[model samples]
Target: MEKERKVFGISWNVFLLGLVSFLNDMSSEMIAPIVPAYLTEVLKVGKLAGGSIMGLIESASSLFKVVFGYFSDRFRKRKVFVFTGYALSTVAKGALAFTQGWLDFLALRLLDRTGKGIRTAPRDALIAESSNGKTGKSFGFHRMMDTLGAVAGPLIAVLLLGLLSYLPKEVLYRRIFLISAVPGIISLIIIALFVKDRGGEVKKKIAGVSSLRSRSLQLFLAVVALGTLGRYSYAFTLWKAEELGYTVLQGSAFYALFNLIYALSAYPIGVYSDRVSKKALIGAGFLLSALASICFAFAQSLPLLVVAFILYGLHMAVMDTVPRAYMAELAGEGEKGTVIGAYHTVVGVFAFPASLIAGYLWNTYSLTYSFLFASAMAFLAFILLQFD
Candidate 1:
């Protein structure tokens, strides 16, 4: 792969996108942990309802990413969708402070996710376009910044909540959520100032679906979807840790450590990817995820859990960023948004079922079974991607 030269080996756009994600994540994380508490403790909803609401939000986010992605490509406009997505999420941050019930919160959550859905594909394509030859490093840098924000978000929430302890607990929670608006606004400013508006150029409008259905893209997406089917959310890892005699404090610390490991690894991995083969790195990522999942399944000691989580971070660092870089490489010029959108759409469509299967296996048999199944599927993806 040829490394596209950029100012400082990465364009200003990469920095801007990374910064935008950092701020957005920090804002989102500040409020995410409190949502369940507000729903159950304040609104009197059951646990099942809260979980279902989150599921809905995830699905909507994924679906909208596809929808907005198609439009982004169809119209050849990226910045406007990106701008709108951030704006909605920014508005949602403020709304979270004022929600009266679970349903209200659900609406805000969906709206927030809708913003995410709109921005993801086009933003990714924009990043890829800016860093033509060095997708790995650029995307890696972006992920690193984003993960750093994820790590910081929870800490900010804690600090803010602590500072507002004089207020009633419920009021304090709302206050904490309200503070998220600051970062949201800042990110929007950054977006307005730094993000370029790459409106579409005139070209023969091919069917977006047909463009996305090239034999190679189809095969790649199939492999990716199969791998994603095995891949469920990270909450199970925390559950596994708690089950293994770890306290909530330990589990929380472990998650922060995992994010730290993920952030630290991404840029270096991207640099290495450019020097070597992205496919091999992607395959290695799945295998690493398999290894990490197995570690989660059998963690008995703190040391083992640490290793598992670190490897888990590594798996994501590789799997998450490298594949996008590869996708950018694989997508045709005008079809980047559509092809990427289709890829995520497949994963979103299958995610609920994947989670359901994982939950069922964990509930019915053993958590080990779920992890093993995921490992096998990821390994299979790695193998299949090689042929691609």
Candidate 2:
């Protein structure tokens, strides 16, 4: 048998998958950082409604993760779902240029998220399969690539906004949305041409169903749920930037800074997690998140907000990259997709309530109250991790 090729100490599939994510994320992040502003400023939606819309958009795809994951395992296919999901998202993003109202935007956003739901689990399972016992390194590299695109995305948007300064703000935003689809299309092409299907064997019974009985997994899930509840939409961060008297372009730059730190830190942290305790690292991440929230709550200067965003980026580097590797480690032979799907589902289900709560606090009390709530919840999650 021919030896499988490796790139950057990972399989070809993993490398190509990372490339796909990089491009796709470039497309997504272009919109992500600006969506809240778009909703409130362009669509004339209120803060609470904007939060609810953002929350629903974030969780919409998560609702499909487990179902599609199980189907991927049962059907013994990955590429098809991955391709279909990317296609759907590309089309939806392109269609954003035509949205006339909040409802139209919501519909397109949900479709884009649905695409994410369909692909995430199966794509992750493929990465886990290709890890070669280096799950941490593989996932880290992938996240690094993905986040690098995130860094590039808002920067691109900033550049576009600057160059298109002559156009109306609404026209400029819509044009950027249309342009975002190009990267998504390129990502799909890469997937079609380079990514190979490497599905696992079919099992007589689903291992995902049995995984629920595991006390450790259950505890981990609870920790994730709590952490997610504290994790508000990134839109709130952008709003914070605006509240500090920054322009939309400046806010996008801050968003890019956050992603740049996340991109730079993810691979090193992921590699370190392999040598040390993932639980310890996760606990630290929660602590950092709490600190970030506290900083955001009290930030009165640009320098302090910068510190908060840096801490937030570090939290993302740990929470986003490590947990996927940990879940893959916990998964049985053929049930990686299902188990990862469950993790995503938990995060997704809780995200709605979490964002709603944050929005409510923001609308009813104050922005400080919202940040304090996140701080409390994250601190609580950190405490819970000790029991695990």
Candidate 3:
């Protein structure tokens, strides 16, 4: 038997996967913080339309996860899907520089998300396979590395915007979008050279969705579905900053701060999740999300908004990291990818209506109403979790 390599006490595959996510997230976040402003201010789209677009884009990205995940498991090949997904996203993101209208932008964004949907479940299955029983620790470390890119990406955008202050806003944003593709390209190279496929073992029958009979997983899925309805796009947070009179550069800085907190907290939370109850941690995260939404609803100043973003970051860390470990643990060995894909699909499907409802509330009513709706849903999710 060949000896497996370890990095930072986790499998080499896990560490490399984290590095891939770090670079990819850096590429994605560089453009993410500014996208809402670009759509609303530059493209002259309405807030409701912008919100719907973002939600649609996000949901589209995850909708394909289940199909691709099943294919990966069925063929017992993980690396091919992973590589193809990254490649598609890289092309889509780079093509953003050429889009002149919202329709074209939406097309490219969908392609990018399709890539994400293709890769997510299989990549997560890779992480689970590589964890060697340290599921929580592995996922947590991956989240930490991934978020560090999230932290760096916005700061980089801030710096670029400052440097290109003399250019027209449209040109500057386009240039940043072009430059963002570099990290993604680098990630692809790493994936091609380093990421290994561990799904070579022959199984007599690959498990399908019907095999996901675990009661705990079903309850977890329901809780995630309910919670997702309240989880609006991050654009709303940036929009709130704009409403409070902060510049885009300042908003990016604030986003970087949120990612910093998430990065710092994720690993410890992941490690603790191994020792404690993942359900309780996820419930606590939901509660924090509810409180954060309430704060966003009432925040009138930058400081209050900062506090809200901090809480949001903490909750994101828990919701994003612990759930993967929990789901991996819940799944049987032959069905990890399918089960995780199902979980992601549920979140994605619910996110569509969630974002639409949030947009309606923000458009027809007020931002406060939208946030209050989010808080109410999150609180309900937290309460429902108790039944599990």
Candidate 4:
């Protein structure tokens, strides 16, 4: 495998695509850390509805990613889908400036995620194709760039809000949304100019029912679904910060910190996964994540909560890079995009219900209970992987 596979190397396409993701994540995270606050405080959507909305958008993206990726595989075209998806996200962010109600917000969220769904698999496919055989390093580099953007977006948001805003609360958020468009434009240009697709002749036929049949992939998807149930979101971390009386600026700062750590760890963890068992790393990630969630739940002071958030970032670094690499490893060569899309779709299918359950538990019971529930789900995912 080592001789046949390139090691510690990547191509120009990979670097360019990573820049595209970097810019896109910068645009996306600019708004993400603040969306819950905007929905809850401005739109008055309530916690459960907000969680449901967030989860629904995510699930919707996964659905589209799967569908588009399947078609892209059949058609052997990836660039158009990638371009169109980023365009859609850019439009969505533009619309956020004028959104006045929950309906508009919902529409914008769906549209934004629609772009995500369309682009994710193709973008990933492009990276994998570029690397040929070093799947771990390829995906890891992409994730690192993506998380670097994640770190920058919040910092940008914080800076803009701090320096340029003296307006009312609503206006301030609107201005932040407007500024998000800058990264979107940057991403569009970077992708259009630099990203390339070299995957050979596409089959041009829909996968028959048999193409979707992979028992190992199915088992892994189930495990991932269970893991996602325990993984509510980092948004909740911001929410908890607010509950602890952290200002929005403070929350954004923490958000940036988390992403910083997450960005730094992505490549190392990916490389490490190649050295060890991917499943073992995933289990370790989940277990550490559970501990972080539990700690977040019981934390009463700002310092402890900050610690939990930092650890949560580490958890994400492991989760985001390794599992996808594992999935790629599990997939047959030509079937990578299909497998990636299917994996995301399956986990996303579970995300909808998981968010609903977590929201209900958070609202009806307590936030602590919600964290505990998330922790339990992580443990379950860890346990299920033993058989794999």
Candidate 5:
């Protein structure tokens, strides 16, 4: 009898890509835990400004995804954009160390997210194409690596903070920012050395524009957009932890917990989706996210918030791995890059407003309102998926 392929295994390309992401997220998470604190405490930026900066960064990245993904597809190139993108991010992170004020920070974040937007679609397309039928596994493995970095990033941040407790606050943050650049450099090197261009698989129709005319693709993008519309920035979670009386370190711990669960579940859910319908998994993820958001809105204490965050992590795991896999399954060969980019761009466009709206709600209404708004959007998205 023929031996079955290893279910938990990934291709060399996927593994290497995962390693790159892992390193990158390590750098990202290192900053992520400190960002809200840095802005509010050190930079003296207000919540509205912080939220706006976050929204703009997300939106800018999505916009770049649209342009870069299309360009890569049309030109049949991926590595150059991918490499350039990572290089931009590395530079952005280094610049963050010397940021003078809110404007400088905003510019740094914009450039950083631009890199993210540029790289995401093409990178995902590469992973999808390489994995063949194991789409869920591929994305899951990648996410797992990414989350591992996420877990480590914050731990290192907290450790550094503790180690440098004797230093002035500004000096402490500058040191951490400087150190975060290490992973970025490492990731750039890995991508350059590995991750060759696997060009021109095939072209397929996309759904967004009426002239383009891929009904299913269009429908999927629309559904994803609507779902993402309620998807607010996760910084709110960290912010809420602070509002609810958690210390900076405590809040970071919660963020770490969230990533831990998210990392652990990513692969299992991916594997499970391979056996079951990805549609069901995606729908479930939306609903669970809604539930988590609601719990977060009502959470009175850190423990309850931890519960909410854990559910949120599970939601992230499902959404991260399954949706793209579903998209790949939906798209025919050769067009995966364009289709994926278009889908993310659409989602990214919505995410920009979603985060902005959440910011507005948080400032004008309440954090509860912001989360409830997200929950409602998630429900609408889930309902629309019924037609799928």
Candidate 6:
């Protein structure tokens, strides 16, 4: 009898990439939970300005995702862009300690997200190429580790705050920002030392990203764009928690809960996606997103907010992992990077107005209107995907 090759169902390189992501998220998440408060309280920025900053950051990320993704495919280079991206982010994270105003915050924040946009599609292409038939399994495993880091990042923040309670808040915040560089540096070393340039495996298609001309990609990107149009910044979630009377520490706890459930469920659902239909999983994700919107819309208490967070994590697991895998499966040879980049860029472009719209709704109508709008969009997306 032949022995089956089974070890997390990913290449050794993919596994190392996952480790890199895990460390990076750990560094990033350490900053994420504190961003809203840091901007509004310490920097004296308003909530609307904060939301706008997030919107610009999202836009920056999208812009870079398409730009670098195409070039990576055009030049048939992956590791170099991936390395530069992470290195830039490491510098940006460390630079946070020196930010003087909202302008500084905006510039540094955009720089950080730019790095993300550059690395994401190429890294995902690398994983998709590596995952083969077990696309979900590979993505699930990566996200599981990424989410695990997310779980730790906020908790680490809370712990650091508690331990350093005696220090001035400004000093403490700067210290945490400085500390984020450690994990980021570790990630850079791993990528530099271990991750190889596997771009040679991909055949260079015609010179540009004409691969997006395919009808299937057109439909997929449209549906996802429409579906994700309402999915706004998760910073809104933390904002909502604060509105509901949870302290910053408690909000971190809620975020941690969300990541915990996400980490635990991501891999199992990813493995299950391999056995079932990817479209079905994607559709289910849309509906779950709708459901979570409703829950967040109606949630009145912290405990109820916890329920919303849990559903939110589940929605991410079902939707986020499957669609990319599906798209990767759909791509022609050597086109994964471009297609994935275009797909992400499209969804992100549509999502550009999300936080702005959410902020507008919150300021003009109410949070309820924002949530309802999101729920309606998600439901519509799910219905459309079902038709596909």
> Using Cα atoms with residue i matched to residue i, what is each candidate's TM-score against the true structure?
0.87, 0.97, 0.98, 0.94, 0.93, 0.95
Which residue pairs collide, candidate 6? none
Regions of model 5 farther than 4 Å from truth: 1-8, 200-212
Report the backbone clash tally of model 6: 0
The residue ranges of model 6 lying beyond 4 angstroms of the native Cα positions read: 1-7, 203-211
Question: Across residues 124-179, which tens digit of lDDT does each residue of candidate 1 receive?
Answer: 87887777578889989999988898778767766665677688867987887788
lDDT, candidate 3, 251-294, per-residue tens: 99989988999999999999999999988999999999999999
lDDT of model 2, residue 75: 77
Per-residue lDDT of candidate 6, residues 1-388 (tens digit): 1222345557777788889988998999888888888888889977667777777777778877877877877777888888889988989988999998989988998899889899988998888766656888998898888888898898998898889879888888889999998999999999999887666776646454566887766887888988877787878888888888887778888888888888898888888888999888888898988888888899997667888999899988777688777877877667778788887888778776877787788878777777888889999988887766
Query: What ranges in model 4 sit over 4 Å off?
Result: 1-8, 201-212
lDDT (Cα atoms) of all candidates against the true structure:
0.77, 0.89, 0.89, 0.81, 0.83, 0.83
The predicted structure with the larger lDDT, 3 or 6, is 3
Comparison by lDDT, 2 against 4, better one? 2
Model 6: lDDT of residue 82: 89
**Model 4, global lDDT:** 0.81
What's the ranking of the predictions by lDDT, best on top?
3, 2, 5, 6, 4, 1
Ten contiguous residues with the weakest lDDT in model 5: 203-212
Least well predicted 10-residue stretch by lDDT in candidate 1: 46-55
lDDT of 5 at 234: 79
In candidate 4, position 373 carries an lDDT of: 92
> Each model's RMSD to truth, in Å?
3.6, 1.4, 1.2, 2.9, 3.2, 2.5
Q: For model 5, what is the error of residue 24's alpha carbon versus the real structure, in angstroms, after optimal superposition?
A: 0.2
Question: Compared with the true structure, what per-residue lDDT tens digits does model 4 show for residues 56-77?
Answer: 8767787887787766676677
